[model samples]
Target: MSKRLAQRADSRETEIAAVAADALEGRVPAGSLVCGDPDGVVEAALGGPVWNRYAYDGRPAQPWPPEGAFPGAVLRQPRGWGAFAMTLHALAARLPEGAPLWIYGGNDEGVTSIPKRLEGLFGEPETLAIKRRARVLELRRTGAPARGGLEDWREVVSVGDAELVSYPGLFAHGRLDPGTELLLGALPKIYADQSVLDFGCGAGVIAHTVRRRVPEGRLTLLDMDSVALHAARQNVPDAAHVLSDGWSAVPAKRDFDLILSNPPLHRGKEEDFGALEALVRGAKDRLKPRGALIAVVQRSAGVGKLFASVLKNVEALAETPQYQVWRGGV
Candidate 1:
């Protein structure tokens, strides 16, 4: 491993990535494919041009798979089991017989059992490396017939009277979460011609619900995950979509009359409030003069104070034992 990777392996956030980098030390070839490289460690360690695909828009790589064949491929395990399975199936279908495939992840991410899962299609994974509580395994593609794609994971979820098409890996994938349900029930009256923005729209449930109330209104759905954006497109076809991290992809001049969300608070397995904090702090700039930001969150998150710090007329719209709906006006 390079000196930089050696240092990264000791860090909590990039330990798995460093392990992946170390495992591929002398094996990576030019034009290799890499997926789910959240920290770009694998690509940087490869030291060559690579075709990379990332689900989150935060990465500079393509969101969808690129066209072409590769000599080898590396996949950094994702947090969601369904996403991992779907990606594995897709890679199995794409790779040619005998092509090397490397998979790596932290122990906490279920990496230890991956060998059993790889036995059928890849013939059996060879243990490559284990360090820093992370493991890397290598296998050769057997070219076995792969079963499904994104469409196979599609589920039609019913939220109240609205039916939404969702797929695996999205937040609240096959059903509505209680927080969003409460927010929906307590939604304020919206004008027919008002413009609305659904921040962190997972599968378009919130946007779809609001769309029914405002047929003449302009709707924009924003999310960081391409998979969630894909489902949002299908669920609310008429609405505009923006694949962004926080408010990065939103146009500065584009202000909305209302913004709604059940914003994400977790990054992988760790509780993260960065996105939520950014949304609250930046909502004032993104909203029109009379606009308001309405959202539902855990009652214990203490988000009401954060909202009051940056926005005016902040109040709790509704509350349940586990959740609270808050509205902050510009």
Candidate 2:
């Protein structure tokens, strides 16, 4: 397997494609399952193979795969360890006897424990390929192990008057986020008939609270992570949920009275402000003339400058020890 891996000048996406192509040629049988490919990259890599492309990110609301047994599968390792572990269980439980389940991820993508984790599940995991800072692991399902399923990771938390259900991978899972609490506290008393947009509606915490506060307000929940959206779908069932890449998934012509977000500041272990910056810059276009973008962020993240660059006026509505809820508008 090591000999088959060769260093190549290819983007991460391309490396992922190469891995997929190789799997199709050898281990991964035809009509196998593909998990967490919301972007359809794995399917495209296999040259449009007929397979169950199970994706969760908010973009498309595909039902969870059937709970029957499957011959084999190829899965992209998720960034969060909890999500990754949950995915491994999800794949393993559905695998038939002696079926190979290929899990792939970059080192930086938080899959360093593939060996130990897979060993506990499938006796021993086979290293398939190691190239371009990425590795593919092969685990053949053989026996049942005492592994906690996704249900074990589930929790119900009460915030304000709403009880939100969240899984391990979801942001702030099993706990209330201080920033979101601050943002929710800072929100105006009444929304009435206004339209509300929860930009990064993790577990629909903000959406649920706001809906209770403003029952007449039309709520639209958006998030790039399918896990978050999946939780949001249940937490705020009546709200319009959208799976999008930042502002791309939202319709430009559809203006909103208010935009609320507790935007994530990190991508995996790296500190990334791309999502937050995009939200600030793009909010004006989606907001009505009097509409405002309200967000809770770390005060030291220099979000004021970001808000100033996009909106003519920016106001810090509330501040805590580590967070500030800012409101900006044209």
Candidate 3:
């Protein structure tokens, strides 16, 4: 496999995607399978059969298991901050007691001690390790039957007071992001009621904020990453959730009153402003006349200048040495 294609689970979304890919390739088997992190599993080896793991986002994901749904079981883990933590929760719930559970990961990702920590919870592990950063561990767990999953989501202290239900692989492990804070603080004045689309709505913070600010507003949260969208569903319960590459699932010529985002600028290292720029251009089509689009990016990105012709007005609400809040108002 090409090194470029064999991605590591650097983040939660990547982790989910990676594991999904691995399941497809055949690296991980279908029996007694519950990957600690889907993304890691996906990118590991290659696509293979996957089963008995849950990927949850509070609201059920479409095309969710059932269709081509593998036999063992796939479910959403209980609410939590880290994918590892959540995955452990999933395993606790799904694994038959006393029927050993195995967790695998890269050493650079700190898997060496995961087994030790796990042994405390599930009993000592049948462990294995090797160079090139890999470890395999199996815990001898008692079949107490999983107690249950977390009933409620937790709120993060930072990141503009954004709310997130914990899930495996999300950054800050159950909290808000600082970059999001800078963006939210500079959000333009949105009306009390409007049709809004939140692209790349990670864990649904912006969507939740919008819904809270405008109780009657129709909100559509779109994200390509299942884990993010799953979190988005929890984060934006009132909003409609769509899984597609940036607006791909959205209908064209359907206008929105407001579109907000702290759009991501990179995809695993190749700086990708393509989606953001596409939004800058196509967003006009999705906006009712004179509607607005708000965004946050590093100052050096110069996105406003790049899309000057597409937008009627582009201004900076907040600017620092490193970042800028640019609003594209029609």
Candidate 4:
């Protein structure tokens, strides 16, 4: 896309958000709604692009959200009516009626359900134009407004002897991701104070685990999505982070003591393996002599072939019914 066209597109996303914001001009929404999506449009417009949902998405990239805490002012919750409870609680605190309640997402992500959910929360919703994948909703105050607090969607999910508290859009929320499990199980012993890199750390499972096991090790994480990177920071404290597409920003000559990743396959219409290949090509050069590249992938994805061709030595181990754990060392 041309620079001017891209700027206009970004501007249009804001315009789309304004439609719903205006709909609630009279009162803060008693409830809110968000879909299972990563479309940057909703938060981008409502509050500015301060919130990122695409980070650590099922991809290997760097983490870029600044390491910090965000105001709970903008409440984030799960899909469906649960979001209503959190949104209502936010409104109850300070944002008043006509404060303009909002719900956002793409069409494919079930933004259409926002209108229906709003019908139950406040009243029928007023919808704006449909975009590529989402929609927005604004509720009228004439409808019933029940008191709702944050308790609506809070739940504990099991993650390998751990109970993780989650609300919405947290990867495999309330539970552990399969790929993450594989990566965790494959972690090799590394000395403390060594620089370790999480190539595509998502939800920070690997990064957090590494931090606990090797607190002295300088942990550096990378991911593609802004939201995932943000979540990673929250999940894995004290680790250095970068946001980019799978070590794309790291110089080819830069070396690391260890690299871990679960490479992503889907890229739009085609499944691009470039990230994995790039990892293999640069990993050898980047490693500290005997540094390792640990990764996991589905057996059907034929990760073994790539590992064999890329590393000085490749070891394949079975983690689960579907995953193959591959570790390459120089």
Best by TM-score: 1
Stretches > 4 Å off in candidate 3: 1-30, 34-81, 98-102, 123-147, 150-176, 224-237, 265-285, 299-312
Q: Give the per-residue lDDT of model 4 (tens digit) for 1-330.
A: 123433454454445445444433333322232222234333443442233334423433221222332222232223345444444443433333444444544354356665555434445656644554445555444334544333354555666766444554445655677877877876777788578988777557777778788877898887775445666676676888787765566777646888888776543223456566767777887788777888887776677777788786889854688888888888
Looking at model 4, residue 58 earns an lDDT score of: 43
Summarize candidate 1's per-residue lDDT along 161-254 as a digit string, tens digits: 7888876677877777899999999899888778899999988999998888777778999887877888889989998998887888776653
lDDT of 2: 0.72
RMSD of 2: 5.9
Model 4 weakest 10-residue run by lDDT: 63-72
* lDDT scores of the candidates, listed in order: 0.79, 0.72, 0.57, 0.57
Ranking by lDDT: 1, 2, 3, 4
Please write out the lDDT profile of model 2 over residues 11-44, one tens digit for every residue: 3446664665565565566767777553566766
Q: Count the clashes in each prediction.
A: 0, 4, 32, 32
Two-way lDDT contest, 2 vs 3, winner: 2
TM-scores for all predictions? 0.90, 0.81, 0.64, 0.59
lDDT of candidate 3 over 1-330, digit per residue (tens)? 112222322443454344334333433335534342334343244323343222222222321122232223222222222544545544566554555555544444565666544524477765543434344555655544442353322344343555457454554455566666677778766775677888778678777877777787788887766666776777678778877666566778846888888776754333556667767877888888778888877776777785577887777778778878777766
